[model samples]
Target: MTAAILLQLVLNGLAMGIIYSLPALGISLIWNASGLFNFAQGDLLTLGGYVMLSLFGKAGLPYIPSFIMTVAVMGIIGYALSQAYFYPMLEHRVNPQIILIGTVAFSVFIRNLVLVIWGTTPQTYKNPFGSSVLQIGELYLMPHVIWIVAIVAVLLITLQYFLRGTMVGTAMRAVAQRPTASYLMGIRNDRMIALTFMLSTAIAAVSGVLISPIIPLTPSMGGIIAVKAMAAVLIGGLGSFSGALLGGVAVGIAETLFAAFVSSTYRDIFIFGVLVLFLLFRPGGIFRASVSEKV
Candidate 1:
C-alpha cells in the first residue's frame, strides 16, 4: 500500500479498534470476576445506544446532559440485571454451563424486547459533531472518530487506574485471582462481583454512546459488534486488560486492511478464520500464558 493509503488505513483501524475494545474490556472484567461469559453484553450495548438515542434524538434533550443520563441509566440497568438474575443464580450454585445458556436467552430476549417496543424500524440519532472531518497532512479523519479514540483512551486509562491504584481496585483484583481467599481476607466477594457487572455494563454503555452517532441505532448492531469484541477478548487473552486493548487494535487494523485490500464482505470471515487459528495454536491469547486457575 502507498504511504498515504497506509496511514488512512491505520487511522480507520484505530477508530474502529477503540469502539471494539470497550465491550471487550467489559467481557474480560466479567469473565475474570464471575467465571461467566455474558452473552447478553452486546444487547446491553444496544440498549444503551437506543436509550441515549431516544432521550436525545427523540426527546430533544441537550447532548451533554443526555449523554450523562444515558450512561447512568444504563449502568443501573446493568447492575440491576446482575443483581436480579445473574447473582441469584450464582448464589444458588447453578451450573456454569446453564448460566451461559441463560445469558444467551437474556440476549435474545433483550433484542426482541427492543424490536417489540420500538418496532422493526431502525432509528437515527443526530451526530453532535455534525459532518465535520479533520485532515492532517495526507490523512483525513472524522470528528467522531477522534472522539472515539479519545474516549477509549480515557476509559482504558481510568480502568487501569481503578484496577491497579485504588483500594477497591486491589480488592477486585484479589477477588478475581481467588474469590474464596478474598472473602476470608474481609473482601466482600458478592459485592465485588456486583461491582464488576456494573462496571462492565457502564463500559458497554459508554461504547454504545460513543459509536451510536456513526453507526445509527439498531437492535441487531450489538450481536455483530459483540462477536468482534469477543474475538478481541479471546485473542488478547481472557481476563487480561492490556491483552484486550492490544487485541482490539490488532483486530481493527486487520479488518480495515482486509476490507481495503480484500473484499469487505469477506473481511469478517478472514478475521474470524484467523481467530480460529489462534484458538487452535495459541488458545491462551497473545498476552497471557495458559493457567489452570481462574483468569
Candidate 2:
C-alpha cells in the first residue's frame, strides 16, 4: 500500500475503532461492577439510533437536544432493566450463566421489537455538519471522523476524572473492584450497580448516535457491532479503560488494513482470525483484570 492510502486507512480505522471502544468500555464497566454481560448492549445502540432518528430526523429537534434525549432514554431503559430483572437476581445470588442468558433473551427481544416498530429497511439522518473534508499535511479526514475522535478523547478524559476525582465515581469504582467490601462500607451496592447500568447504556447510546451518521440505521447492525466491540473488550483486557481503547484501535486498524490489502469481503474473517490468535495466546488481553472475593 502507498504511504498516503495507508495513512488514510489508519485514520479511518482509528475513528471506527474509537466508536467500537464506546460500547466495549460499557461492557467492561458492567462486567466489573456486576459481572453480568448485558448482551443487549448492542441492541441498545440500535434503540438509541432509532430514538435519535425520531427526535432529530422526524421531529425536527436540535441535534444536541436529540442526542441528549437519546442517551437519557437509553440510560432509563438500562436502569429499568437492572432494577426489574438483573438486581433482583443479584440479590438472590442468581446463577451468572442464567443472568447471561437473560441478557441474550433481552437482546433478542430488543431486535425483534425494533423490527416490529421500525421495519427492516436501513435508515439514516441528514448530516448535521454537512459533507466536508479536512486535510492536514498529507492526511485527509472527514468531519464526522474528526468529531468521533474529539468526542472519544473528551469522554475518556472526563471518565478518568470522574472516576478518580468524585465521591460517586470512587464509590462506583469500589463496587466494581469489591462489592462485598463496598457494601460493608455503606456504599449502597444496589444503587451503585443500577447507576452502572445507566452509565453503560448511556455510553451505548452515544455509540449508536455517533455511528449512525457513519452507517445506515438497521436493527441488525447493532449485533454486528456488538460482536466486534466485544472482541475489542476482550483484546483490551477486561476492565482496564486504556486496554479497551487500545484493543478497539488495534482491531479497527487491523480490519481496515486487511480490507484494503487482502479482501474487502473477508474483512470480518481477518478480524476474527486475529481474535482467535489473541484468544489462544493472550487470553487475558493486553492487561489482566484483578478480582478479589471476600467471604
Candidate 3:
C-alpha cells in the first residue's frame, strides 16, 4: 500500500475514533460515579443530534448557538433522568445488575421514542462548514474531521483539569469513592450524581452534534454507536478515562486499516475478533485500570 493511502486511512480512522471516544469516556465517567453501566448513552447521543437538528436545521440558528443549546438541553435531560430515575433506584437500593438492565431497556425506549417523533426517514442538515477541505502537502482533510479532532482534544484537556483540579470535580470523586463520608463532610451526594449525569449527557450531545453533519441521522443510528462504544469501553479498560480514548482510537484505526488493506466485507467481524483476542490475553486493555476486570 502507498504511504499516501495509509495516511489517508489513518486520518479518517482518527476522526471516527474521536467520535467513539466521546461515548466511551462518558461510559467510564458514569461507571466510576455510579457503579452502574449506562447502555443508553448512544440514544442520548441521538437525542442530542435531533435536538441540534431542531435548533440548527429547522430553525436556522447559528451553529455555535445551536450546539450550546443542544448541550444545555441534553444536560437538563440527563440531570432530570438522574433525579427521577437513577437516584430513586439508588435510594431504594436497586440491584446494580438490574440498573444496568434498565439502561439497556432505556436505550430501546429512547430509540422508539425518537422514531415516534422523528419518523422513519433519515435526516441531514446543512453544515456551516460546507464541505471544506484542508490541504497540507499531499494530504487532504475534511474540515469537519479537523473540527472533531480539535474540539475533542480541547474537551479532553478540560475534562482532565475538571476532574483533577476543580472542587466540584473533587467532591464528585469523593462521593463516588465514599458516599457516606462525603455526606458527613457536607457534600451533597445527590448533587454529585446529578452533575455526573449532566456532564455525561452533555458529552453525548457534543458527539451527536459533531457527528450529525457527517452521517445521516436515523432513529436506530445510535444503536450502531452504542455497540461500538461498549466495545471500546471493554477493550480500553473499564473505569479508565485514558483507556477509553486509547481504545476508541485503536479500534477505529484497526477497522479502517483492515477495510482499506484487507477486506471491507468482514470489517466488523474483524473488530469483534480483535475484541475476543483482547479478552483472552489483555482483558485489562492497553492502559490497564488500577483495578483490573475480567471479560
Candidate 4:
C-alpha cells in the first residue's frame, strides 16, 4: 500500500517480466519467420540450465566461459533440430499439423532426456554474483535483478539493430513476410528458417542462464515458464517485436500486483484472465499488426 512497498513490487515484477520476455520473443520470432510453433522452445531453456549446471556446478568452470559455452551448445542444438526434424518434414512434404505434433513430441523427449541424465533431483544454479543489495532510501534492490534487466535490454536492442540494420536480418524479415516471394528474390528460405531457430534458441538459452539462480532447476522447470511465455506472445501481438516487449512486462507487473493485493493463488488466474479478455476483444494483440504471408 505504501510508496516504497509499491516500488519494490514493481521492481520485482520488472525482473520477472524480463525473464518472460526472452522466451516470448523467441516464440514470436519463430512463429512469424518459420510458420511453425516450436513447442519445444521452453525445453531449450531447461537444457541451457542443465548445461550450465554441468559446466559451473560440476566442472567448476568460471561463469563467463560456462555461459558462453551453454549458449553455443544451445545454438547448435537449435540448428540441428531444424536440420534433423523440420527439414526432413519439409522434404517429405509432411503436413504442418504433423510438424507441430513433432515439436510436441520433441518437447516431451527433451524433458525426459533431462530427467534421465540429471535425475529427478532439483538442482540449484549458483549465482556468479554474490548476494549484494542496493539500498536507496527505504527501497532495497538485488544486484541480480538489475543485471537481468540490463542484459535483456542489451540483447533486445542488439536484436532490433540486427533486424533493421543488417542484410541477413532484412532477408529474414523478407522470408517472414513472404517465403515464396523471398525465394523469388533469391533469398534462401530454408537457411533463414534455420537461422531463426538458432537465434531463438540462443535467446532462450540466455533466459535460462539468467533466471536459473532465482528458480529451482528441474526438468519441469521450463514448463511453467513456457506456458507463461506463450500467454505473453498472445497478449503482445503474435508477430510484433515491440508487442512482445510490452506484453511481457505488462503480464509480469499484473501478476505481481494481483498477488500482492489479492491471493497469491489467484495470480495465474488473473494473468490468464487478462489473456482471455485479449483473445476475445483484441486477438491481434496489444499491437495490431499481422504477419504477412504470400498465398
Candidate 5:
C-alpha cells in the first residue's frame, strides 16, 4: 500500500478505535464490579443514540442540550435496570450463569421494543457540523473523527483520574477486589454496583451519540458492536483500562487493514478467530496478574 493510503487507514482505525473503546470500558467496569456480563450494554448504547436523534433531529432541540438529556435519561434507565432485575437476583442468591441469561433476555426485549417503537427502518442523526474533510499532509480526516478521538481521550483520562484520586473511586476499586470485605468495611456494595452500571451505561450512551454522525442507527446495530467490544475486552485483558484501549485500537486497525487488503466478508470472522485464539492460549487475557490466595 502507498504511504498516503496507509496513513489514511491509520487515521480511520484510530477514529474507529475511539468509538469502540467506550463500550469496551463499559464492559470492563461492570464485569469487574458486579461479576455480571451485561448483554444489554450495546442495546443501551443504541437506545441512547436514538433518544438523542429523536430529541435533536425530530423534536428540533439544540445539540448540546439534546446530548445532556440523552446521557441523563440513559443513566437513569441503567440504574433502574440494576435496581429492578440484578438487585433482586443478587438478593435471591441467583447464579451468575442465570444472571447472564437474564441480561441476554433483557437485551432482546430492549432491541425488539426499539424495533416496535421506531420500526425496522434505519435513521441517521444530522451531523451538527456539515460533512467536511480536513487534510493534513497526506492524511484526510473528518471533523466527526477528531471529535470522537478527543472525547474518548478526555473521558478516559478523567475516569482514570477519578478512579485513582477520589474516595468513591477508591471504594469502587475495593469493592471490585473483594465485595464481602468491602461490605464488612461499611461500603454499600449494592449502591456501588448500581453506580457502576449507571456510569458504564452513561459512557456507552455518550459513545453512541458521538458516533451517530458516522454510522446509521438501527435496532440491530448494538448486537454486532457489542460482540466486537466484548472481543476487545478479552483481547485487551478483563480488568485493565490500558488493555481495553490497546485492544480497541488493535481490533480497529486489524479490521480496517484486513478489509483493505483481504476480503471484507471475512473481516468479522477473522477478528473473532483472533479472540478465540487469545482465549484458548491466554485465558488470563493479554495483561495478566498473579494473585496469591490466602489460607
Candidate 6:
C-alpha cells in the first residue's frame, strides 16, 4: 500500500480499536467487580445507537440534547440489566455456568427486542461531523476518527484519575481485588458492583454514539464488536484496564493491516487466529496482573 493509504489504514484501525475497547472495558469491569460475564454488553451498544436515532432523527431534538438523553436512558438500562439478571443470580449463589447462560439469554432477548422495536431495518444516526476531514500532509483523516481518539484519551485519563483519586473508585478497585475483604472494610460490595454496571454501560453508550454515524445501525451490528471486545479483554488480560486498552488498539491495528495486505475475507480468520494463539500461550495476556500478596 502507498504511504498515505498505509497511514489511513493504521489510523482507522486505531479508531476501531478505541471503539472495541469501550465495550471491552465495560466487560472487564463487570467481570472483575462481580464475576458476571455480560454477554449482552454488545447489545447495549446497539441499544444506545437506536436510542440516539430515536431522539435525534425521529424526535428532532438537537444533537447535544439527544446525546445527553441517550446517556441517561442507556445508564438506566445497564443498571437494570445488572440488577435483574446478574444481581439475582449472584444473590442466590447460582452456578457460574447458569449465570453465563442467563447472560446469553439476556443477550438474545435484547437483540430480538431491538428487531421487534426497530423492525430489522438498518438505521443511521445524524452525522455530527458533516463530512469534515482533517488534511494532514498526504494523509486525510476523518473527523470522527479524531473525535473517537480524543474522547478515548480523555476517558482513559479521567478513569485513571477516578480510580486513583476518588473514594468510590478505590472501593470498586478493592472490590475487584478482594470482594470479601472489601466487605470486611465496610464497603458495600453489592452497591459498588451495581455502580460498575452503570458506569460500564454509559461507556458503551458513548462508544455507540461515536460510531453510529460511521456505520449502518442495526440490532445485529454489535455482534462482531462483542466478539472482538471479548478477544480484546482476553488479549489485554482479564482485569487490567491498561491491558484492555493496549489489546484493543493491537487488535484494531492487526485487523486493518491484514485486510489491506491480505484478503478482507480472511481478516476475521486472522483476528480469531491471533486470539487462539494468545489463549494457548500467554493466556494471562500482555500485561499480567501482579499476584496479590498475603501476609
Please state every model's RMSD to the true fold in angstroms. 1.6, 1.9, 1.8, 1.8, 2.3, 2.6
Worst 10 residues of 5 by lDDT: 286-295
Clashes of 1: 0
lDDT per residue for candidate 3 within 77-128, as digits (tens), equals 9999999899989878888888889999999999999999988799999977
> What TM-scores do the predictions have?
0.95, 0.96, 0.95, 0.95, 0.95, 0.94
TM-score of 5: 0.95
lDDT of 1 by residue, 1-295 (tens): 5798798888888888877888888998998888888888888888888888888888999988888898889888877888888888887989888999999998999899888877667788778877777888887778888778876787778888999999999999898888889999999887788889999998888888888766777888889989999999889998888888888889999999999888999999987998899898898899873545542
Off by over 4 Å in 2: 290-295
lDDT of each: 0.86, 0.87, 0.88, 0.86, 0.84, 0.85
For candidate 4, write residues 68-174 as lDDT tens digits: 99999999999888877786686577887898899889889999999999998999866776777889899998888888898889889999999999999999999
Better of 4 and 5 by lDDT: 4
Number of the top lDDT candidate: 3
lDDT of 1 at 277: 92
Candidate 5 yields a Cα-based lDDT of 0.84
Clashing pairs in 5: none
Instruction: Please identify model 1 stretches exceeding 4 Å from their true place.
Output: 289-295
- After superposition of all CA atoms, the RMSD between model 3 and the true structure is 1.8
Per-residue accuracy of model 5 over 205-278 as CA lDDT, tens digit each:
99889878778999999998888888888898877788877888888888988888998999999999999999
* lDDT ranking, high to low: 3, 2, 4, 1, 6, 5
lDDT of 2 by residue, 104-213 (tens): 99999999999999899999989886677888878777888888898879888998898889999999999988889999999999889999999989988998898876
lDDT of 1 at 42: 86
